[model samples]
Target: MNVELSFMLKKMLSVALMPWSIAILLSLLALFFLYRHKIQKAKKYLTISILWVILISWAPFANLALKPLESSYERLENIPENIEYILLLGGDRNNRAWEALRLYHKIPNVKIITSGHSLHDPISDAEKTATKLIESGIPEERVLMQAMAKTTFEEAQHMKERVGEKPFILITAAYHMPRAMKLFKKAGLNPIAAPADFNRPEETGYATVLQSKQLKNTERAWHEYLGILFYKLQGKI
Candidate 1:
């Protein structure tokens, strides 16, 4: 029971990360100040207002932070010689999932695994990914789904139970790969990372990359940065 409670905390902590940004942070502090002199009702209203924005942007914030982490797995070099299974992580987009499925089609006798959970994400993450892979002419038998996992740690742990004695390739965003790999390692699964969906730097100037969108990107990067730290503290990785 303590373990399950801790897992839930980590999951919620991942979403709460967006509000840790300066934009939301300052807004929260300002509201706290504004409520200091106000009635209880005013304090409640302000609290509600802040929570709403935080919830609304959680997904986008996650998406933003994940950009670079998503890119870390991208390999310009040709495929290495010994991969036997490919594991794709789930998110808003199936970018890595599609890539893994494609690789499955190209390779010989390799299997694909999709790990996900139906939590805040309404769409079935692992199942949706598996559906696509099966549609692509890869035999249904070659795909494995670990649908019960909601966190990166559980995803890797559960995947190991399903996949044994195969050279596995784990696909996820580059920034996320670091933490995911750590979790996979802790789970006793050795997986080579395959990252996708990079948030690239501008060749011309840093200014272009520092636009509002980029600031948002940094907010997301900060989230992943902080998230990894917390995971480390908890030994979740």
Candidate 2:
């Protein structure tokens, strides 16, 4: 299969397999069964859908799915003495951009490289992130934008061209760091993981609270898990 086509297929499959997508698909199937007067099957599908949503949204289950990924690398501390760049991978633009900014404060000499492409929006994520960094008082020249790469593997490929053998801080979500590190290393670039957008809280309560936040965390972790598997099969990591 062509690489771009394969990437799109994987994305579609991942979106279809997300928790909310599964729940919605099940609900739709239940309605179809009801229209056919198969009341028992309808009830079974509906019940399973409800249970699936509840299970995914419960805090304990979300924590269980997320801890392994988020804990793969501890938050980066002790910036290296003379790093030249901070490579901010694209996702959750605000928090990740803020993280790059904070790191810039600590190491003012390092340039920030924002990497991502536009998806449904006119401006690319890389440009948006770079604009945020510049608005936060970082000089325009200090922020670079590589807006063509749409996936982590592509980002690593671009970084290889831009900064091969240079030890740079890599900024991305905490849960995504493990996969990101592997991809960058595969591309033969030196990336120091600086994970941001942490999903797990310090204190998770002992109750199964049904909330969207927990569901979001579960979805994020699920995506990373799927991404790792997909990349492994494709020999990207």
Candidate 3:
């Protein structure tokens, strides 16, 4: 499939498969059933829809699904002396860039490479991130942009082309690190994981209240899970 089409399809699927979307879909189906006078079917679908929304938004339920992904990789300590670059994959741009900025301070003489492009923005995400880094006091020369990659698989491909087998720090969200590592390694790049943008709280809590933050975390976790599965099916990992 063409890359653009594939990306579009993935985006559509992602929105469709989200918990909120599923709940809405079920509710709509229930409405249709009710219009047709199928009361039992309508009631069944409506009940499931309500339950699904409540479950996904509940704190304990969300935490149970999200913690594993967030905990997959610990923060990078004991920085290797040989590391010369930090490949920061873009998502939650501020958080990821903040982590990269912090790492740049610790790692001497290292260039930070930012990768990602946005469909809705005219400027590529990489260039935007690079500009932010420069404004944050990173030397403009030390910030490189690889903006062609729109997905993790493409990011790995572009990084491999630019860096070859050279080792570098790979910074991404904690939840995304596991799949990011797999894709980069498969692309033949040696990446040391520097997972950041952690979504899970350090202190565990079990609350029955519906929280939007918890729902967001659950969505993020499912996104990674779906990404990994999609990549595997496409034979990219």
Model 1 accuracy (lDDT, Cα) = 0.67
What ranking emerges by TM-score with the best candidate at the front?
3, 2, 1
**Over the stretch 36-121, how does candidate 1's per-residue lDDT look in tens digits?**
86556556656765664554345444454555575656652366677777888874263666667657766788878777788566
Give candidate 3's root-mean-square deviation (CA, Å): 1.6
Off by over 4 Å in 2: 1-8, 202-207
* Per-candidate alpha-carbon RMSD to the true structure: 6.1, 2.1, 1.6
* TM-score of every candidate: 0.72, 0.90, 0.94
Of models 1 and 3, which has the larger TM-score? 3
lDDT of 3 by residue, 102-131 (tens): 889998899999888888889888888888
For each candidate, the alpha-carbon lDDT, in order, equals 0.67, 0.87, 0.87
Model 1: runs farther than 4 Å from truth?
1-8, 19-22, 31-78, 91-94, 120-123, 203-212
Q: In TM-score terms, which candidate is top?
A: 3
Clashing pairs in 2: none
Better candidate number, 1 or 2, judged by TM-score: 2
